[model samples]
Target chain A: MNVTIIGTGNVGQYLIRFFSKIENINLQICGRNSNVLHQFAVECECATVDSIKKIDTNADFTLLAVSDNAYKEVIEQMPNVKGIVIHTAGSVPLAVFGAKFNRCGVMYPLQTFSATRKSDFKNIPFCVEASDTDTLNKIHKLSKKLSKDVRFMNSEQRKVIHLAAVFACNFTNHMYSVAAKILESQHIPFAVFQALITETAKKACEMNPVLAQTGPAMRNDQSTIKSHLEILESNADLQKLYSFVSESIANFKKQEDIND
Target chain B: MNVTIIGTGNVGQYLIRFFSKIENINLQICGRNSNVLHQFAVECECATVDSIKKIDTNADFTLLAVSDNAYKEVIEQMPNVKGIVIHTAGSVPLAVFGAKFNRCGVMYPLQTFSATRKSDFKNIPFCVEASDTDTLNKIHKLSKKLSKDVRFMNSEQRKVIHLAAVFACNFTNHMYSVAAKILESQHIPFAVFQALITETAKKACEMNPVLAQTGPAMRNDQSTIKSHLEILESNADLQKLYSFVSESIANFKKQEDIND
Candidate 1:
């Protein structure tokens, strides 16, 4: 298979690393940044293109891995293609390609990615959606080259999954930063809470997440909640979040009681 | 070393399991219910005490692993100890033991525990605190038996850590439940997001959490945020939460821009 990946960002670079390892695929990497593109090409051992226009016109597929904002412009500017076109965006929909391309799809990897961090895609879920059956299957088979878990969803469903990823992956990660900030202010090591964070994620996955919930917030311990709020006295944003999340947990616990 | 554990709850039972493996520790497990206590005794091969009164007075240390609410009453009721009397509640202050027990401390394992699920404590952080130096050292050394990362903090510091734990562990787990609930309503498997959750946790620990952050919220993409809010329109609580957390993230991103 001849595959051209546009955008040498984290998702694009990682895909280069992944497809480079595959024996049969001929992969070409493209991005505007010549230095970054050259580095990725050398590192991942894939062909590099200075512009999307230079991408192989006869390639079997085009993996659009640019920023969400760049997708529309990139789709508009890139040379028209007959091969399968797939995007590696979370929230962006497949319809963005519209009738412009005969074959197009979405190939969203629901995990946090950064240009510097090397991530394992083996168990990561690839959300695949396409304009038609042939394109969907092509994207699916190709996605299997990188990930074990692949699920087919339409535009609406992928958006929902992306929203959930925001909460599960993005928001959950920000909570770690929040905790780290709190600890840093106190001159405590960020690691003092690392085990707890790891355990919380593991336990939620192991059991029903609601049942796995614990802490003063879940129990509605007003005194502890008040204490926590007091600690966040200077940060109005944190105080608000602490109150809202605690109230939500308490409300859920109450609803569970009524159901019981 | 003789150790008596007061409470047969998840933390207590897990402590029983952890301590059972160590050869030199003579362990006694106690709780209100005989069936449960006897069951733990039979399963873990530890001595069972029907009440705190039945625990041997000569024990080197006593672990109070009961719920936060029960700490005050349980501490008052437990037999006076010459050795350190430690409670496992995170938010509860070490000052709670002052004037009550000559030797008292805290052995808070910073992880969520459920009675049914067994957890490995080898890497979990134990936030140890005590009323006095001798008790602190004793608790610190004992904490090593259960976990490698043993941190010493004062009552105020531990309370702050506990507060931080509520954000890092409790609030983060709640986010998983929230994401799962959204996906569950859409007939999508919660397992789809499991890899993302695991990666988020692992990545946050590996790098500076704030720097590791990603997603639409972090980007302040109003369009994506609006789209997500539209999907969550019917659920007011979720809508409120989604809006608040996103706003907080956007605010943080704005602050980061200023800093940069």
Candidate 2:
């Protein structure tokens, strides 16, 4: 199958490299930056284009790997393609592509992608959403080639998943940043927290997070929690965060007790 | 060094097995429950003791791997001896041991220990803290036998590190539980989010979390954020958490720009 990928950013680059590895698949990578396009073309041994107009309409699939805000414009720019048009987005709806194409869907990889690291997509879950059965089947087949874990999810389901990810991944990382900042202010080395941070992740993987939850907040150890608040007293944002998350965990534990 | 682990819970069991694998180190496992101690002794090929009074104080080191609340009682029960007394605790202060013992310290492994899965302590940081240089050196040497990464940190530093870990690891996992609940409520499989969670953690490990942060909250995409809040309206606690974290991220990004 012939495939045209739009965008040469991290997501685009990773997808190009991933699709290039699959057998019997023709790939074309397009980006606004000619230099990036050329670099990717040279690296992945695939066709490179400077504009969406250059994308072959005869291709079996046109994958939009562009930013969510730029998605609508790129979809409009693609030459009246007869092939399936899909986007690699988590928040945006599939209907953004409209009903003009023969088939349209979303092939969202539920992982954070970076060009520097080789992503192991084989076990990564692919949330596939399509407008029709034929398009879904094609996307499914393509996803299977790259990953073993695939799921059919609607736009609403995908949005919820994305929101949860914001809390789980993005916000959680921000929490790390807050902790780092606090440590930095206190003249402590970041390495001091590295082991604890890693083990916390491992613990969550070992069991249900609710059960694995530990901390002054989770235990309702008011003395330590109060001391932590005092330490974070200067930063209003962190103080607010500390109070909010602590209360949330306490509430969760209380509800858990009720359920039990 | 001859070591006696005074708890047969996850941490105690894993530590016993780990110390057993190290040559020249004699390990004796103990717990209040004789049955559990017998099982650990048989399975791990170590001696067991039912009472703290039966502890071989002549051993090179005694590790109190019990719960935080039970720490005082356990320490009080142990027979007074000359060997180093170390506890594996993150929040509990070293001063808790009092000046009764000449050699007292902490050998806190900053990771969640599970008996089911073998942990590679090679990368796990061991935060060693003590009242004296000799005790600290001895603990450091002992930590080197288990992990390559060992650092001497004060009690205050370790406490802050523990707080940061709550944000990075514990809170992050709670976010996953929230995501799982959302998926479950919508009749969607929770496995769909596993890839995203793993990749997110891996991404943070590669880059500064500040640079890697992305989402509607980070972007300040009010519309999508609003939509997400609406979806979570049924969950008041979750809604509050979502708003608090999103606002915190926005505020943090603002501060970052100002600093830059």
Fraction of native Cα contacts kept in each candidate? 0.85, 0.62
| Poorly placed runs, candidate 2 (over 4 Å) | A23-26, A186-199, B20-30, B45-57, B69-79, B115-117
lDDT of 1 by residue, B215-251 (tens): 8787767788888899999999999999998888888
> Candidate 2 on A34-153: residue-level lDDT in tens?
888888778878998888888888889888898777788887777998888889988899889777776899999887776677877898888898998988999999899989988898
Q: TM-score of chain B only, all predictions? A: 0.95, 0.95
Docking class of 1: high
lDDT of 2 at A225: 77
Model 1 chain B is weakest, by summed lDDT over 10 consecutive residues, at B75-84
- State the lDDT at B167 in candidate 1: 87
List each candidate's DockQ score.
0.81, 0.54
Model 1 residue A132 CA deviation in Å: 2.2
Could you give the interface RMSD of each candidate, to one decimal?
A: 1.0, 2.1
Q: What's the lDDT for all of these models?
A: 0.85, 0.80
Candidate 1 segments whose C-alpha is farther than 4 A from its true place = none
> Where is the poorest 10-residue window by lDDT in model 2 chain B?
B190-199
- Tell me the interface RMSD of model 1, in angstroms: 1.0
